[model samples]
Target: MEWLERMNRAIDYIEENLTGDIELSEAARMACCSSYHFQRMFSFITNVTLSEYIRRRRLTLAALELQHSGVAKVIDVALKYGYDSPVSFARAFHALHGITPAMARQDGIALKAYPRLSFLITIRGADAMNYRIETKESFEVFGIEGIFRTDGDGEAPQTPAKLWEQSHANGDVKQLEARAGVLPSFVSQDLYPVNAVCSYRKTGPDTFPYMLCAFKEENSNTDGYTTVTIPAYTWVIFPSEPHQWEQFGDTIETLYRRFYTEWLPTAGYEQVDGVEFEMNGTKNGLNYIELWFAVRKI
Candidate 1:
């Protein structure tokens, strides 16, 4: 459980610095992974963004202090929690505890509490994940991309989600498909060829670069698109069991959650520094996507 131990050390760093500036990159270092991977893994495991978790923790500590310390001023508590002013503090406090900070000091008052978080092993069910490993030559893809920041202060970073919405709304999705020629059988016909591409090497720390791209063949139009080459590497591709289009988001979330929590801990390979693919395809009259992870032998 070395990986989990490293993760806990990162959490310890956050808890110690909750009232001060938290360096997300340091947390990732403590966990022995990139900031991008740390944020994503934390979200998948906890079902909450790192930022939201931090907010709840700060509010939880504030409530406890208010309820017990008679001399602790509300404004002081707000300041201690890094809130700029009382009004902003109160708003955030009320959102979490359903009562004003002053009201928290009253007797018989009830407030919500979010305890510190830690990870441990559990008996996961025997659900199988169908995956294949392959090493292919370098390939190029062309599409539009957006720069997204990683949430380092335990905040959730809005990302690929926003990119997906923009592409769909702006007709980038339709345009890419119309420009695409004949694709391999493995390619998805339901939504896109490649739904989203995220990786560690193509960008900087504290930043996640995502692209809504498709396989760029020779003579593929390069205008109005950014072309990137995906270097050759061993990939572990997990093909999701087919399900309705309505279940797309839920299905993908489940797949990620399981991969990090259940599979990686025991797998013989470790995820390396490279790009990941969310490839779209269809099966059983439904939609599916293959999760392509860059990996190397552990």
Candidate 2:
């Protein structure tokens, strides 16, 4: 199936299972990608997490049922939508619609609704994407790792920055740099940070491991640091532009948003099962960064 069709089918699957158990695995299956890639793509394209999208959809439907169904019990409606108890349902419902279930039954109560989503291919060549496709062999990286939750908003989360600060304060970054045998040459600085997803299947809803890392030799002793192996795959690298330091985060976010939303459906490529990473560097006195995603031809 085509990428757009696969994504639309995923949305259809979610709609069909809204009143039942909706598994990320099932959605990913329909989308023809791994759960991690599907979730990441969905968030980047829709600007909301999968869990958040599901919750809003469920609450939206629940509000409609409450407002229109004259004799339906609140507990029945809640249980139908996978809420274990009325209290939990009420909390979620109020959070989304800003009105209680009982209040929704009263006349003229306005409720917000999250409509079903569909995918389309939009031709967006206004801003040329500075990216290239390359294949690389398996490599190892040694780094200091920390757990971080990616926020729903496009902004970079503060947790990774905090981890970097902690590592610097404790001298772990310097120690790692000193022990490094094969340093990352992309950056002029001695320390090169690579943020990567840990394990796709094991990652929590919002949490993944972020690593401040450098390339290491085969025999290098990684006594205190965590070592991760990046498997060989074809990667699409998005190189940063010069003089965009002030809009760095926003630019990266826009690139991602465009890549997933506008590019993927027509790119004739699909993301493979692997961790994605961001490379932070500097070149010729300008800040440089690149996003790397493992992919395969569709």
Per-residue lDDT for 28-135 in model 1, tens only?
A: 888877788888889989989888999999999999999999789999999999999999999999999999999999999999999999988788778777778888
**What tens-digit string does per-residue lDDT give for candidate 2 at 1-298?**
3988999999999999999988778788888766656887899998888889999999999999989997889999999999999999999999988988889998888989889988876656687777788888887877777655544333444566677777778887778767766554442352254343444334564445668776767545688887777777788877767545787688678778877876667788887753567766666666666777788998
lDDT (C-alpha, whole model) for all candidates: 0.81, 0.75
State, as a TM-score between 0 and 1, how close model 2 is to the true structure: 0.83
Model 1, poorest ten-residue lDDT window?
Answer: 151-160
Pairs clashing within candidate 2: none
TM-score of each: 0.88, 0.83
**lDDT score for residue 291 of model 1:** 89
Clashing pairs in 1: 50-154, 50-155, 51-154, 51-155, 188-281
TM-score, prediction 1: 0.88
Off by over 4 Å in 2: 146-165, 182-210, 218-221, 243-246
